[model samples]
Target: MAETILALEGATKRFGGVPAVRAMDLTVERGTITGFLGPNGAGKTTSLRMSLGIILPDEGRARLFGKAPNARTLDRVGFLPEERGIYKKMVAEDAVTFFGRLKGMPAGKARQRAGEMLERVGLGDARKKKIKEMSKGMAQKVQIAAALVHDPEFIILDEPFSGLDPVNQKVLESMIRAENQAGKTILFSTHVMEHAERLCDRIVLIAKGRKVFDGTVNEALGTVPRRVLIETGEGPDAAPVLAAHGAVTDDGMTGEGTHRYTLDLAPGSDAQDALKALVDAGVRLARFEPVRAHLHEAFVHLVESAEREPA
Candidate 1:
């Protein structure tokens, strides 16, 4: 049995009697990275806020460390809200130290930890830099350092990658992996599927304020049809053999005499088997590629399915 770090039972919230999150259930286990994923206005932020006791759920409950959230329990958690809150006038180190002190660290220890955190986040030279003086990416990193300065047992980052350039996004991803490797449990909410697909051990997807799926990345991928791209001579038409494999569609010609086709592998069928069938049919091959389903595709597929369901 896994040790659960956080659990939500029918956790729900509303604004002006309009539900933003409805009967959402979630569990984040110890020492694992969980992704709380959804599109904009899908209630991810609402759910996270409710989980941390920052906002009360209209109905249902939230538990942290097997008990109702309280100051002592919250002390063991570090959080970065989706909205940035660092003070523009404060120096980078001072901001981080301030957060550490708020978490109960002594002044001396908090200052020391702040220095270490700033250095760890690549802001050693920026320790004295004011938040207003740093680039958006640098300021974001400073906030991240502040969140970790307390060295909490669990960390919740709400859209940590939002607004970061591609390079900085990769940097944040690496930092996340490093922290998880240090045995800290993490739960991050993101509308971006690429980040979750690469970093999560398990993912919980929300749409329209309700959870629609909960599983590993592979399981999520399985929700959509497996796709493969095949290329061959225009003759013999790979369609005949591919039709038996799954849904086949022409992908347009690639060159003067070569054509491309897409195949959605049938249930329990293998791509290799389909390729073999194409070869056995004497189809001249130019290119044969297996296209793996991305988490974005799975996210879209699941959300659309939920929409189709009669509410």
Candidate 2:
């Protein structure tokens, strides 16, 4: 069995009599890239803070590497907070080196790693530039470099892609893949589903401060019903025929006098079967294509379902 890197049992937190997170259980296995995903204000940050022992949970407990988090254990972890900050006047390399030193790296080695990290993050030219002199995206990368310079075994990133442009986001994604390939366990929180879909080996989804789903990408995607798109020449008989195969909904018109409808295939039903049924019924087909489920769709489905449950 894979070792557990981080675990939370019945973790809960609240502020001003309002719950921020409630009875959450999560685990990240060693050597895997885990994605902590949710919308804004979904208690993701609170949960992460609790996991790192930066903030104590009001109830339950968090175990880091099978023990409570402390200076010794925390030293082996790298964290990039949702709120980014650094010495505005410190040069980029010096800023990264400062964080490395904080993590107990020797001064000379810290400086050396700082330079290498800055260069790896595409900020080598900006190494001599002060944080105040850099753009928002550039400064964010500097903080990322700092978090990673010490080469910690476990990495936790919260909202790491929030401010970057597409190009820089891609750069960060590449860095994450490279780190995991180098045998680091990673957990990152993001509202962007595409990033999680592309990078995570497993995903934990939170909504309204509670976990809604935890599983592999394929398992999550399975929550969304199988669907297919079918277009037929505005015929009254088509809707009835389509409904026999699965739940049918009218999609907006595609072209002149052509209507599009989404058919959610029933359990034990197949798209090919639906297509054949439509053909057998002599429905004039304009288009017939299977609709693939996506992580974003699954996220919405799970979250919305959770929201409707009694609190």
lDDT of each: 0.92, 0.93
lDDT of 2 at 254: 77
Per-structure clash totals for the candidates: 0, 0
lDDT, model 1, position 223: 95
Q: What TM-score against the true fold does each predicted structure earn?
A: 0.95, 0.97
- Hey, what RMSD does candidate 1 come out at? 1.6
Per-model root-mean-square deviation over C-alphas: 1.6, 1.2
Query: Candidate 1, after superposition: displacement of residue 40 in Å?
Result: 1.4
Model 1 error, position 217 (Å): 1.3
Per-residue CA lDDT of model 2 for 1-311, tens digit only, reads: 99999999999999988999999999999999999999889999999999999899999999999999999999999999988979999999999999999999999999999999999989998899999999999999999999998999999999999889999999999999999999999999999999999999999999999999999999999999998988888445677887878899987777577888899988888888888888888888888989899999999999999899988
lDDT per residue, candidate 1, 101-198, as tens digits? 99999999999999998888788999999999999989999999989998999999999997788987998899899999999999999988999999
In model 2, where do residues sit more than 4 Å from their true spots? 234-236
Model 1 spans with C-alpha error above 4 angstroms = none
Residue 115, model 2, lDDT:
96
lDDT of 1: 0.92
For candidate 2, which ten residues in a row score worst on lDDT?
A: 233-242
